[model samples]
Target: QQQVRQSPQSLTVWEGGTTVLTCSYEDSTFNYFPWYQQFPGEGPALLISILSVSDKKEDGRFTTFFNKREKKLSLHIIDSQPGDSATYFCAASAGSNNRIFFGDGTQLVVKP
Candidate 1:
Protein backbone atom coordinates (compact mmCIF):
# COMPACT_ATOMS: atom_id res chain seq x y z
CA GLN A 1 0.00 0.00 0.00
CA GLN A 2 1.24 3.49 -0.86
CA GLN A 3 0.65 6.14 1.73
CA VAL A 4 2.08 9.53 2.59
CA ARG A 5 1.80 11.25 5.93
CA GLN A 6 2.64 14.80 7.01
CA SER A 7 3.38 15.98 10.51
CA PRO A 8 2.26 19.10 12.38
CA GLN A 9 -1.22 19.45 10.97
CA SER A 10 -0.81 23.18 11.48
CA LEU A 11 2.14 25.52 11.81
CA THR A 12 2.67 29.13 12.81
CA VAL A 13 5.76 31.02 11.73
CA TRP A 14 6.68 34.61 12.22
CA GLU A 15 7.76 36.79 9.37
CA GLY A 16 11.41 36.19 8.57
CA GLY A 17 11.29 33.00 10.57
CA THR A 18 11.75 29.52 9.28
CA THR A 19 8.99 26.99 8.56
CA VAL A 20 9.55 23.30 8.70
CA LEU A 21 7.30 20.39 7.79
CA THR A 22 7.97 16.70 7.64
CA CYS A 23 6.51 13.86 5.62
CA SER A 24 6.91 10.11 5.52
CA TYR A 25 5.89 7.46 3.04
CA GLU A 26 5.32 3.76 3.43
CA ASP A 27 6.12 2.86 -0.16
CA SER A 28 9.78 2.75 -0.97
CA THR A 29 8.96 2.67 -4.64
CA PHE A 30 8.02 6.33 -4.53
CA ASN A 31 10.83 8.15 -6.29
CA TYR A 32 9.47 11.54 -7.17
CA PHE A 33 8.32 13.81 -4.36
CA PRO A 34 6.80 17.20 -4.84
CA TRP A 35 5.60 19.80 -2.38
CA TYR A 36 2.63 21.95 -3.33
CA GLN A 37 1.24 25.13 -1.83
CA GLN A 38 -2.43 26.09 -1.98
CA PHE A 39 -4.10 29.31 -0.95
CA PRO A 40 -7.73 30.15 -0.27
CA GLY A 41 -10.51 31.25 -2.64
CA GLU A 42 -10.20 28.29 -4.95
CA GLY A 43 -6.70 29.16 -5.92
CA PRO A 44 -4.72 26.77 -8.03
CA ALA A 45 -2.14 24.49 -6.51
CA LEU A 46 1.35 25.96 -6.72
CA LEU A 47 4.37 23.78 -7.04
CA ILE A 48 6.80 24.97 -4.39
CA SER A 49 9.56 22.52 -5.09
CA ILE A 50 10.47 18.95 -5.88
CA LEU A 51 12.90 16.36 -4.57
CA SER A 52 14.24 13.08 -5.83
CA VAL A 53 14.97 9.95 -3.86
CA SER A 54 18.09 10.17 -1.70
CA ASP A 55 18.64 13.77 -2.57
CA LYS A 56 18.25 17.26 -1.16
CA LYS A 57 17.16 20.29 -3.13
CA GLU A 58 17.09 23.97 -2.36
CA ASP A 59 15.91 27.00 -4.24
CA GLY A 60 15.68 30.56 -3.00
CA ARG A 61 13.92 30.39 0.37
CA PHE A 62 12.78 26.81 -0.01
CA THR A 63 14.59 23.57 0.68
CA THR A 64 13.66 19.90 0.54
CA PHE A 65 15.20 16.77 1.95
CA PHE A 66 14.57 13.24 0.77
CA ASN A 67 15.74 9.96 2.22
CA LYS A 68 15.13 6.87 0.17
CA ARG A 69 15.97 4.30 2.80
CA GLU A 70 14.16 6.11 5.56
CA LYS A 71 11.18 6.86 3.35
CA LYS A 72 11.03 10.42 4.64
CA LEU A 73 10.83 13.86 3.12
CA SER A 74 10.86 17.38 4.50
CA LEU A 75 10.45 21.00 3.47
CA HIS A 76 11.91 24.12 5.00
CA ILE A 77 11.06 27.72 4.23
CA ILE A 78 13.60 30.33 5.07
CA ASP A 79 12.40 33.81 5.89
CA SER A 80 8.76 32.92 6.07
CA GLN A 81 6.51 35.72 4.91
CA PRO A 82 2.89 36.55 5.64
CA GLY A 83 2.03 35.96 2.01
CA ASP A 84 3.39 32.47 2.37
CA SER A 85 0.56 31.43 4.64
CA ALA A 86 -1.22 28.56 3.00
CA THR A 87 -1.81 24.83 3.01
CA TYR A 88 1.19 22.80 1.90
CA PHE A 89 0.92 19.25 0.66
CA CYS A 90 3.62 16.64 0.27
CA ALA A 91 3.04 14.14 -2.52
CA ALA A 92 4.89 11.16 -3.88
CA SER A 93 4.72 9.06 -7.05
CA ALA A 94 6.26 5.94 -8.50
CA GLY A 95 6.92 4.41 -11.88
CA SER A 96 4.29 3.46 -14.49
CA ASN A 97 1.21 3.66 -12.26
CA ASN A 98 1.23 7.47 -12.31
CA ARG A 99 -0.59 7.31 -9.01
CA ILE A 100 0.12 10.08 -6.55
CA PHE A 101 -0.22 9.79 -2.81
CA PHE A 102 -0.63 13.10 -1.04
CA GLY A 103 -0.51 13.93 2.61
CA ASP A 104 -3.48 15.51 4.32
CA GLY A 105 -1.58 18.79 4.14
CA THR A 106 0.04 21.14 6.63
CA GLN A 107 -1.79 24.38 7.30
CA LEU A 108 0.78 27.16 7.68
CA VAL A 109 0.18 30.63 9.03
CA VAL A 110 2.84 33.23 8.76
CA LYS A 111 2.34 36.12 11.14
CA PRO A 112 3.63 39.53 10.33
Candidate 2:
Protein backbone atom coordinates (compact mmCIF):
# COMPACT_ATOMS: atom_id res chain seq x y z
CA GLN A 1 0.00 0.00 0.00
CA GLN A 2 1.20 3.51 -0.73
CA GLN A 3 1.77 5.59 2.33
CA VAL A 4 1.87 8.83 0.36
CA ARG A 5 -0.29 10.00 -2.50
CA GLN A 6 0.04 12.94 -4.88
CA SER A 7 -2.65 14.29 -7.12
CA PRO A 8 -3.04 15.48 -10.72
CA GLN A 9 -0.50 12.90 -11.97
CA SER A 10 0.51 15.66 -14.33
CA LEU A 11 0.42 19.46 -14.65
CA THR A 12 1.06 22.16 -17.19
CA VAL A 13 1.77 25.85 -16.75
CA TRP A 14 3.11 28.80 -18.65
CA GLU A 15 6.22 30.62 -17.76
CA GLY A 16 5.86 32.87 -14.71
CA GLY A 17 2.81 31.04 -13.47
CA THR A 18 2.61 29.00 -10.33
CA THR A 19 1.77 25.32 -9.87
CA VAL A 20 0.44 23.60 -6.80
CA LEU A 21 0.87 19.89 -6.10
CA THR A 22 -0.90 18.14 -3.27
CA CYS A 23 -0.08 15.06 -1.23
CA SER A 24 -1.45 13.03 1.65
CA TYR A 25 -0.02 10.28 3.78
CA GLU A 26 -1.47 7.41 5.78
CA ASP A 27 1.21 7.12 8.39
CA SER A 28 0.84 9.00 11.63
CA THR A 29 4.47 8.57 12.54
CA PHE A 30 5.67 10.43 9.50
CA ASN A 31 7.46 13.53 10.69
CA TYR A 32 9.53 14.62 7.73
CA PHE A 33 8.21 15.60 4.36
CA PRO A 34 10.41 16.42 1.40
CA TRP A 35 9.58 17.47 -2.11
CA TYR A 36 11.80 16.45 -5.01
CA GLN A 37 12.17 17.73 -8.55
CA GLN A 38 13.42 15.51 -11.35
CA PHE A 39 14.23 16.13 -14.95
CA PRO A 40 14.22 13.49 -17.65
CA GLY A 41 17.08 11.03 -17.38
CA GLU A 42 18.09 12.47 -14.02
CA GLY A 43 17.56 11.44 -10.45
CA PRO A 44 15.22 13.37 -8.20
CA ALA A 45 16.75 16.16 -6.16
CA LEU A 46 15.53 17.63 -2.95
CA LEU A 47 13.58 20.80 -3.60
CA ILE A 48 12.08 21.63 -0.26
CA SER A 49 11.21 19.96 3.04
CA ILE A 50 9.21 20.47 6.21
CA LEU A 51 9.00 18.88 9.60
CA SER A 52 5.81 17.88 11.36
CA VAL A 53 6.40 20.72 13.77
CA SER A 54 6.68 23.19 10.90
CA ASP A 55 3.77 24.36 8.83
CA LYS A 56 5.83 25.61 5.92
CA LYS A 57 9.17 25.54 4.21
CA GLU A 58 10.47 27.53 1.28
CA ASP A 59 13.35 27.78 -1.08
CA GLY A 60 13.88 30.16 -3.99
CA ARG A 61 10.92 29.22 -6.17
CA PHE A 62 9.72 26.24 -4.23
CA THR A 63 7.60 26.13 -1.13
CA THR A 64 6.10 23.30 0.90
CA PHE A 65 3.15 23.59 3.24
CA PHE A 66 2.63 20.77 5.69
CA ASN A 67 -0.31 19.82 7.89
CA LYS A 68 0.72 17.13 10.28
CA ARG A 69 -2.63 16.87 11.98
CA GLU A 70 -4.28 16.23 8.67
CA LYS A 71 -1.43 14.12 7.32
CA LYS A 72 -1.28 16.24 4.23
CA LEU A 73 1.10 18.53 2.39
CA SER A 74 1.45 20.58 -0.76
CA LEU A 75 4.27 21.90 -2.87
CA HIS A 76 4.09 25.24 -4.60
CA ILE A 77 6.30 26.22 -7.48
CA ILE A 78 6.40 29.94 -8.14
CA ASP A 79 7.61 31.66 -11.28
CA SER A 80 7.24 28.53 -13.32
CA GLN A 81 9.73 28.53 -16.16
CA PRO A 82 10.41 26.37 -19.17
CA GLY A 83 13.23 24.79 -17.29
CA ASP A 84 10.86 23.92 -14.52
CA SER A 85 9.27 21.28 -16.68
CA ALA A 86 9.92 18.09 -14.79
CA THR A 87 8.44 15.58 -12.41
CA TYR A 88 7.78 16.45 -8.79
CA PHE A 89 7.62 13.89 -6.03
CA CYS A 90 6.35 14.11 -2.45
CA ALA A 91 8.01 11.96 0.18
CA ALA A 92 7.67 11.27 3.88
CA SER A 93 9.80 9.71 6.59
CA ALA A 94 9.25 8.70 10.17
CA GLY A 95 12.72 9.85 11.26
CA SER A 96 13.52 6.27 12.24
CA ASN A 97 14.22 2.85 10.80
CA ASN A 98 15.59 4.52 7.68
CA ARG A 99 12.20 4.14 6.10
CA ILE A 100 10.95 6.65 3.56
CA PHE A 101 7.83 6.70 1.48
CA PHE A 102 7.36 8.38 -1.88
CA GLY A 103 4.26 9.35 -3.74
CA ASP A 104 3.72 8.96 -7.44
CA GLY A 105 5.23 12.01 -9.07
CA THR A 106 3.35 14.77 -10.84
CA GLN A 107 4.76 15.60 -14.24
CA LEU A 108 4.90 19.34 -14.93
CA VAL A 109 5.22 21.09 -18.24
CA VAL A 110 6.07 24.74 -18.68
CA LYS A 111 5.35 26.19 -22.07
CA PRO A 112 7.00 29.33 -23.33
Best by TM-score: 2
**Candidate 1, clashing residue pairs?**
none
Which pairs of residues clash in candidate 2, taking residues 3 or more apart in a chain or in different chains? none
Provide the TM-score for each candidate, comma-separated. Answer: 0.90, 0.96
Regions of candidate 1 where Cα sits further than 4 Å from its true position = 49-54
Put down candidate 1 lDDT per residue, 1-112, tens digits, no spaces: 5399998999998999999999999876777888988899765374655646347888789989887778888999999999989999999888569677889999999999
What would the per-residue lDDT of candidate 2 be over residues 7-55, giving only the tens digit for each residue?
Answer: 9899999999999999999989899998888999999998888999899
Identify the candidate with maximal lDDT: 2
lDDT against the true structure, per candidate, is 0.85, 0.92
